[model samples]
Target: MTTLPASAFLGGFALTFSLIVSLGAQNLFLLRQGLRREHVGAVVAFCILADILLMAAGVAGIGRLLQAVPGLAAWLTLGGAAFLAWYGYGAAQRAWRGGAGAAAARAAGTPLAATLLQAAAITLLNPHVYLDTVLLVGVAGSALAAEARPLFLAGAGSASLIWFAGLGYGARLLAPLFARPGAWRVLDGAVAAVMLLLAIGLLASLRGSLGIGQQP
Candidate 1:
């Protein structure tokens, strides 16, 4: 068996961290939960665990299977896009109505299972997660020498753990800032903007995939 270099591990870590750092649905949901101070540890752990599971599958070659199934990808992408768009619209509506922060904070009163389910939905419902992790990351990891693969996996896993942890815990510090109504409005506006951008990007990608917006 060959041993992977430390550099390979670092490279993998950077890739994973960069990819996960985006302001997507999963991150936004986690951030909201964190701000509410509800099951912060559980939410973070679930995200990290999900990342580990997905990364392992990617390293194990499941990503290739997903790539080979274009039909499956299309269906999953459509479903994920619809869900995201709906969620984004709903969030935006709530923000526009005002008191969204308080409402979200109150939602923290729900059962732990409910929160977990919400997190899972945000993470697993999106087909892009599989494409990003299993296919893209997996293919990248496969390019390294056999010995370096494990190091790369370690780096990616570390990024997930660190990122989710920071997202969950760091949100608490912003609670005081959000206590002011104006600040809450700004946060909601920011969240709405991120959600809308993600939705638009997904739709555009789907249009391109369907050959609806191609140049002659």
Candidate 2:
């Protein structure tokens, strides 16, 4: 048996937390689900599971495969960008129009299966996730001794589990505030801005990779 390095554990936790704590499409959607009191468990579970699987795959040398096929990354980037753009447009529309009616309608939320499917799509389809969680984080894990890799991965996985659980459950605290239609609009608008910005970033990266003029 080998002792795990404390530094490796902490480093993995910090890196994973920082990468995921930001306001991205996945977070935005999670927040919305959390606020709406929908299938937050499923949402959070799917996200954490996705992170673990991706990270594991990356550490297991999937990153090498991804790096070899640059075109795959390009396609994922474009697809994810388009998805983000669509979601952003929808969120913007909701921001502009959501009111008491929207809040009330929340009770009749989307089907659980559909929600889970969409959640899966958002988590899996995003190209940045592969880059950040799988390839980058995986490389970091690989740096540690094989014995320490498990600890590093545990630390990384812990961040995902803790963060998603907190975000989803803690969101209910704002239920009172979200009671106001104006609040929903504000939240939706914020989500829209974040999603749109991310989409633009992905699109720019794709363009740059493809040598598409000075678009950025």
Candidate 3:
């Protein structure tokens, strides 16, 4: 095994953080769980573990399944994007119609099993996670030398660990603001926007693939 270069580690860290920093279902759920102060550690661990496995799989070139069969990725993306759109629409409905409200939603207090299962679903069931972590990050990391791949994986895993830790633990700072329904409205609206934007991107990718397949 060759010595891992600092550059490899840094590259992985920067790239992972850039992708994970974005707002998504997983992050939103994490934030909610944090504020609710329910099983925060389990939630954070599940996310980090998912990230690590996905990133590792990506760096190992398992994500090439996406390129090997774009059709597969496209199909999976279609279903997943549809689900995301529906989720976003629900959030939008809540924002506009004044649905359960944040505190009330929190008070609903799902069982820990249910909460953790949802967390797993958001992380593993979501097609975008596979696209971003396995396909995108994997292809990017594959650009590095073979010996440096481990360092890259380490960096990516570290970023997930750090971000989830901070987000879950630091959520209390926002608890005061999120207490207000108005604040919940803004948060839900932001979540809807992110979900819709992701859906748009996924559909666009499928369209591009179809376009390419039809040509010559």
The candidate scoring highest on TM-score is 2
Reference-based TM-score of each model: 0.87, 0.93, 0.82
- Which tens-of-lDDT digit does each residue in 49-103 have in candidate 3? 9999988988888887657975677777787678678778877876775546645
Compared to the true structure, candidate 3 yields what TM-score? 0.82
**Model 3 spans > 4 angstroms off:** 1-4, 97-102, 212-216
1-216: candidate 1 lDDT, tens digit per residue: 334477878888998888898878899888987887888899999999998788878888888787777788777767777777777776676677667655665664758998898788778868778877887778888878777888889998999999999999999898888776666566667777776777677778878889996788
For candidate 2, report its TM-score: 0.93
| Model 1 clashing residue pairs (backbone) | none
lDDT by residue for model 2 over 91-153, one digit each (tens)? 888887787666656767899998998787678779989988988899999877888888899
In terms of TM-score, which candidate is stronger, 1 or 3? 1
- Cα deviation at 81, candidate 1, in Å, is 1.3
Of the two candidates 2 and 3, the one with more favorable lDDT, higher being better, is 2
The RMSD of every model to the true structure, in order and in angstroms, is 2.6, 2.2, 3.2
lDDT for model 1: 0.80
**Scored by CA lDDT, what does every candidate get?**
0.80, 0.87, 0.82
The lDDT, on a scale of 0 to 1, for candidate 2 is: 0.87
